[model samples]
Target: MLVIPAIDLKDGMVVRLYKGEMNSAKVYGEPFEFARAFENYGAKWIHIVDLNGAFAGIPKNIEQIKKIRESCNLKIELGGGIRDEDTIKQYLSLGIDRLILGSIALKNPTFVIEMAKKYPIAVGIDAKNGNVSIDGWANTDSTSAISLASKFKGSKIETIICTDINKDGTGNGINLDFTKQIAQASEIPTIASGGFRSDDELEMMLSDKYISGVIVGKAFYEGWINLRDIFVKYQA
Candidate 1:
């Protein structure tokens, strides 16, 4: 399992939100330096979310994201505001390792599947109370997380990132059951996102065959889990 660090960019600043609340952003600093720091911490990947892009349907942090790619060697997988073929091509042109489609996946699963056939892609299945949320978690749909994930089964997608919005940014613990259900339903390699707050939880997820990796945001920024130590133990 990879202890992937996250950098949520909003207006060129790094922030972490509470339960996907746009107003709850806590700014840390610029993103490129943090990407460098994560690389130095032995991370093989950096999960970046453009908070501005997600909510606004525009790439508001492209320059900031470019800096991250220029500064670090960590394989970058980016999401948020990625809606069309052009945007996907643009990001890949800048050397982003992969793309995670969220809102677009909910609205156009076929488009995503077609693109995944040629490009490195992943799907973000953010849910609340088992229902999928889209448009940057601002809207909830009737589709269940598992149901959405099942749509990508056999697609050329890289993975499905299952995030529990209620538990996200709470620094509580991961929703292991929810993640397991999505992974099983999709039968795809899955990555757990949000609420990864403790070492005990990490250990449990590591042993889980269904889970391929995790995205660590609030927990690492808040010092709930020491990245250096976790990397030393898990990266090897």
Candidate 2:
């Protein structure tokens, strides 16, 4: 399994929001340092979310994101405020290895499907109470997480990142069962995100063949998960 480190940028600073709430953002300084550190630890990919972009539907933390891309060797998978072809092309030109469509994917799967065939793309399914959430997770819809994931069955999409929004930044634990449904439904390698807590949680996810990766956020920022140790054990 891949241990992907996350850097969530809110107004150009690294921050983690509790349960996806903007008001609960905990600043952790500039993003450049963290991206470099994660790269040094042997991470193959870095997960970056422009918190401001997600809400505004336009890339807001461009310079901060560019700083990370230029400083680190890590392949970047960026999501947020990327709804159109122009924004997607802009980030790709800035060296983003992958683009994850979240809100737009929920609202228009056809557009997402078309984009997937043309670019290195992934689908982010942020679930709240087992239903897919959108608009930076400010709204919940009737579509089930499994149902939404199944929509990408034969697409060229790279992967599905299933995040349990309720558990994000809580350090409670990852919602493995919730992720499993998405994995099976999508029939694609899925990455689990949000609420990552312990080595035990990693062990459980590692045992699952369908879970290709796990996004570590608050757990790593809080200083418990050793990136080098995790990389050696899992990705070595």
Candidate 3:
């Protein structure tokens, strides 16, 4: 499985929030340095979230994103505030490996399918309260995660990143059962995100072949997860 480290951007600085709460954000220095550190730890793909953009409904960290794209060659999967096709095209034009549509995917699935068809790589799906959350994880609607994932059955979406909003940044371990159920229902591969705390948690995810990837954030930033050793051991 691909080990994707997260780089959440708020005001052009790397940060992480508790359960997607904007007020609980903690800045982690420069985005450039964070990207390099993840790269050095052997991250082949970087997961970036525009926390401000997600809440504001517009791209908020474009400048830093551009710098990271130019600085490192690691594949990037960016999500947050990507509401329409124009914004989708802009990011792809800049060479972002995958564009993850969260709010749009939950609000207007048709647009998600259209973008999936047009973009070479597209990912969608966000979770909350055992249901799918939309509009930047601000609201928990009635739609079930599996049901929503089934909509992309024939779409060109390469992967779907599913996060347990309740578990996010809690370091309580991923919602594997929920992710496994989604993976079983969805035709496309799935990536598990949020609450990935330790090497054992990641190892449990790795054991599941259906989980295409795992996105690590707080655990990596807080030194709870030693990514360098994890990568080296995995390689061995």
Candidate 4:
């Protein structure tokens, strides 16, 4: 399994939020520096989220995202505030490797299906108490993560990034059982995100055949997990 690093962008700065709360965010540094550092540490891919854009329904950190793209060679998968074809095309034109659809995937399944046909697209399913949440986890949809994942069966979705909101940024380990369920339901390779706290947890997650990769955020940024050693042991 690939170990992907997450860089959550808020107001053009790299930050991590507790439980997806915007108010609880702690800024790290410039996003490009983080992207470069991850690349230098041998990360094959980087996951970025535009926190400001997520709540606005329109991308707010395009310039910063573009800078990161230009400064690094690592494959980037970006999500948040991406709502239309124009934005999708814009990001692709900027050389992003993949686009992650969250709110729209739940709000308009047909559009997601259509987009998957033309581009390398991944759907992000953020769940709280088994129900999918949208608008940056501020609102809960009446659909279960499994139900939502089941909708993408046979589609060209490249991956399903399943994040457990309760464990997100809490360093409590991942919701492995539910993550596996999402992978099975979607019938697509899934990336487990949120609450990855230790090398053992990462090793356990990597052992799951259903999982394609793991996204490490706070655990990585706060020095709870060492990226260089992880790359040497796992990806190397």
- Best-performing candidate as measured by lDDT: 4
Q: Deviation in angstroms for 227 in model 1? A: 0.3
Q: After superposition, how far is residue 73 of candidate 1 from its true place, in Å?
A: 0.6
Which whole-number lDDT from 0 to 100 does residue 31 have in model 4? 97
Tens digits of per-residue lDDT, candidate 2, 61-138, equal 999999999999989999988999999999999999999999999899999999998999999999999999988898
Tens digit per residue, CA lDDT, model 1, 1-236: 97789999988999999999989999988898899899888999999999889988768899999999999999999999999999999999999999999999999999999999999999999999999998789999999998998998888998989899999999878898999999999898889987888889888998999999989998888877789889999988
Q: Comparing candidate 2 with candidate 3, which one achieves the higher TM-score?
A: 2
lDDT of 3 at 114: 81
For each candidate in the order shown, give its overall lDDT on alpha carbons: 0.91, 0.93, 0.85, 0.94
TM-score list, all predictions: 0.98, 0.98, 0.95, 0.99
The predicted structure with the larger lDDT, 3 or 4, is: 4
Q: Over the full model, what C-alpha lDDT does candidate 3 score relative to the true structure?
A: 0.85
Please give the clash total of every predicted structure, in order: 0, 0, 0, 0
- Pick by lDDT: 1 or 2, better one: 2
Cand. 4 TM to true fold: 0.99
Query: All predictions: root-mean-square deviation over Cα?
Result: 0.8, 0.8, 1.3, 0.7
lDDT of 1: 0.91
Clashing pairs in 1: none
Tell me the spans in candidate 1 whose CA falls farther than 4 Å from its real position. none
Q: Write the per-residue lDDT of candidate 4 for residues 125-178, one digit (tens) a residue.
A: 999999999998899988999999999999999999999999999999988998
